[model samples]
Target: MTATASSPAIIRGATLQPRPWANGLGISHNIAQHGDGACGFGWMIATAELSGDAAFSHYPGIDRVFTIIEGQGATLTLEGSGPLRCRPFVPAGFPGDQATHCTMDGIPGRAFNLMLDRAGWRGSVTAQSLAAGHRMSLRATAIHCLAGQLAIGEDVLEAGDTMLPADNVTVAAQGAAAMALVVEVAARVG
Candidate 1:
């Protein structure tokens, strides 16, 4: 679907299909992607559910951002780097080609994942909270609601729903408060 400045595209989390991880250790629900299938995507977004200790899939020439959304979180051990503590609402960035391992905190956890092709794209994720009636302008590529509800134009977004804006937009908190993850994607400059 084509999203215009006046109308953004919404992806409902419940409608996403689950796909097995490349390493076959976990499952992920693909949210959105861009680029040609023949050469692979320039960027992709998804939510992953990890149940136990496991190694991450390697994606050469790509960068990744993983944010814990539910549960107690996990520890990520990336090759050539110190162990990363992944807690709820915190996003961690790393090279997708790096050998990485994840150790969960006993129970299963869910995370939002972003992958970008290093040669052409760069991206970042930021968590934000908006008070009731508060509005925030978005220059972001996408925004995922983590809690509460948000109103963007005539559309209302609930937790787990994601919106891709074609241009800068503003979102307002619907109730008491709302939490979201704003994602920004841009072409890599040489």
Candidate 2:
């Protein structure tokens, strides 16, 4: 469930378990979390599946980024901002404490989520696609494969596999189609 700061961790999708939400509207599978769910955490990477509409859980002092990993995606209605349309591979960043609700894309889908404590850490999410014979410099903290396969360092990742790569590791596509979601999390600068 935890990895040292100096090493990378490979999280297999098959090992993840569905964690039911308090509201019972959706479920989340934690890929990596810094603290106990009952208490608080510094950062967290999770895969969430929503079958219908629901309000996002409030996390005070946290910043969150969400990317659609499957299906058509959804729409996020924020309190002050205009509605944000989230499509596959497009990551959206928002304040975790905002009064937010999501209207599903009429079909069940999953999203990759990153949550960081605003006071202690910050995070970003990006989508990556690579063609064969190309190399990608993976400086991000983690990556989740969405299509094809990637050879990152010594590991080969297929769709749904999450890898926390060492700093500055390089990645390459094994075939013609390779895509993933990259996440970077770091301590907040003063």
In order of appearance, the predictions have TM-scores of 0.94, 0.91
lDDT of 1 at 46: 92
Tens digit of lDDT per residue, candidate 2, span 76-110? 99999999999988999998888899998879788
The residue pairs that clash in candidate 1, if any, are none
Cα lDDT listed for each candidate:
0.89, 0.84
lDDT of 1 by residue, 75-174 (tens): 9999999999999999999888999999998798899998999889989999999999999998988899999999998889999999998988889999
Model 2 regions more than 4 Å off: 1-7, 35-39
